[model samples]
Target: MESPRGRRQKRRKTFFLPLGTSDGSYKPRQRAGHARSRQTGICQVLKRPESATNTVKTITGRLKNARTNPSPKIECWIPEKNPSNTGLVILPGGGYGGLAEHEGKGYAEYFCRAGIACFVVSYRLGTQGFRHPAMLEDALSAICAVRSAAHDFSVNPGRVGIMGSSAGGHLAAHTLVAWGQYESDVPLRPDFGILCYPVIVSQGPHAHRGSIINLAGNDASPELLEDLSHEKHVTSRTPPCFIWHTWEDSGVPVENSLIFASALKKHGIPFELHIYQKGGHGMGLNAPFNWGAECLRWMSGITGHKTA
Candidate 1:
């Protein structure tokens, strides 16, 4: 498949690789609030090679899911300066069925250029027989892994945060709200959060059904749906957040970010929300109305680090 438009930026060192061709085909389902169908976008057949290895240069680590088919991997992109004070773990949104490489590498390189170390996580999806907890676990694990290895990557463990787009935003939000609730090998909570057009409500008017289905399956119970609806879980303890959405985003409704931001506001959590008049779903880090700089500036304000 050809790379998405605007992905041809000057490259940085990376261990992240494109997920190979799909054997299964995807078809778009027409439904209300469906945003974009799975068939029309990048959701292709799954055919990941078993021989893929982690990179030593960029601190790529495979969080093997021995119980599943597509093993989760963490691709780190450390800034050239090394020992940066802050870092980010990125979760690319693909409706929880597939990973979007553009969101992964493209966003990582964008942040890396700003002097913030980043790790793009390709986690196990529900289509591979995994479910909600697996994606959440992989996200938390990626944060822990980054924090544990902060010294090696020249990052401050205390300054690490998580960022995600669309469905991946749901995972990042879950991580922020429920970090200490789960058992993990290292520190679980991120210092802050950056969610771009996230899937927040699992069962509301703004709910993203495909993302919900991919994470919890088509027959998810009411109880499961309630549990995964992250807006209801926000508390004063949740980390500060930076959220943005496009007003014209037909895929993941802009209301997803609005409702989540409202929840954050209700809980009195520090946050910054941006709703741009243009740009639609899955734009990655494309230029012309890209909000990456604004996000980075907000990050710098919180972390007390100058933008690279």
Candidate 2:
């Protein structure tokens, strides 16, 4: 087999191609108070199945219909020089209500500067009346899209990983464990995971109630709750992970990361866990600690990339 660096050298320029769209005219809404960063190069909206559209009543007693629902999309970014053979799919946290541009676009820019290709996923949200498998489906789809087109993005297919913050971290952990349960043409399992202050418990004192309720509804079943609690789902098949959380994260308690890391240990999965002494929730790339640098170092070790 050719070396991964050799594959990077043959990479073509990246392009925005709709993965599962028909008309190819879907445009995601811009969340108020969050500006789109210039670092996000181009976006491609992936279409969901017709069955994905179901009228659901949100917590606010308002009806959300397919006409108003936004499909999942991916914003792509590729480095201009000496790109590494690694790709990352970012899932930003919004309590399942919105996407955090800083976690999405800001992370993309930071990682791209280190010669890593990035894809920021705008996944279906609970506030938008999506739930459970919908968010999971979108996450898997984004991974498949990036891996399937790894050459175009100048990354090795086997080096693609998933990263999420807060609720997005929950989704990333869920994807890591539950990917084998879903069927897909291309491999849907991420090679690794990077979780930042994720919400891991779905039905406990440590659970972020807003995220649990938004994702599974107030009437979620016991079995569903257990399933959504990603810590309960970790198996040997789950990939290696790099998890970080602040002890001062009041939003999603530090115990969430602890429990998940414990599960990883139980399954004999190699992982790196970082607990910062300070920093509140949603700090993104602006945390007092240099988590980005640490994560880059971890990526280099995993991918064996000298320049990562």
Candidate 3:
């Protein structure tokens, strides 16, 4: 793909490399466009190799029923100039049922312009009869995929981070707190996190009920709910986070951000919290706020790059 100014910016569609298997005998499947950079506008769909199915089961204890949805994949966006060594995996929010385009591609475009390599994850969703660990598995796989392919994307493996909006924020948080439970040769924890008006607690007056129901179902047990409530699981190991929420976001209450920030504080984790008094849910990069700019500054501190 090319920008309107006639600058070359290539966007590629590719499947994540299969993660390590139980026996540790899996070899990465090779493809013609595995790391090709081109100006072609047509997106070539790369089939998920069979080895990845084993990887899914290894990560989440079960594979997503293939009949319910297509396998999860990521859309790559590399900057046209001075690409930063930083890479970010973006998870878009749709209450665990759908993906918000603005939050996915829109955020990707914004960060790619600032020289960050971006991957927009089309992870498994709950509305498709999928549930908790399915989404969590995909999130972990994305982090591993990016770090494993850091050389191909011109990114520093240690600088890779995860960003999500709304329910996607919950997914990011879940992956952050729950990473220690999953074993992987590749690091599953993000170096940092950017959560925009995330759905935090799974059971509370402030919880996003639709997200909880879709993720855990009405018959979910209290133990599962407590585990999914990310705030309750934060520890010193959790990565530094950048969180922002609007006081007017009724869809997912601002308290979600508040309590999570409070948890991060309790653990003495480095973080930045921004509370805007305007905008509702799913505003993406459209709101008349400088949260994006502030995030760039924070990211600069993390990456030691002048992203602004």
What are the candidates' C-alpha RMSDs? 13.6, 12.2, 8.1
Clashing pairs in 1: 22-45, 83-154
By lDDT, the better pick of 2 and 3 is 3
Error of 3 at 81 (Å): 3.1
Whole-structure CA lDDT of model 3: 0.75
Worst 10 residues of 1 by lDDT: 37-46
lDDT of each: 0.72, 0.75, 0.75
**Candidate 1 residue lDDT tens string, 55-115:** 2222222233322222346776666663236879999999999889888888887788778
Backbone clashes under 3 angstroms, per model: 2, 0, 0
- TM-score for each candidate, following the candidate numbering: 0.77, 0.78, 0.80
Candidate 2 residue 107 C-alpha distance from true site, Å: 0.4
Q: Score residue 47 of candidate 2 by CA lDDT.
A: 29
Ranking by TM-score: 3, 2, 1
lDDT of 2 by residue, 21-66 (tens): 1121223332233223322122332323223211111111011221
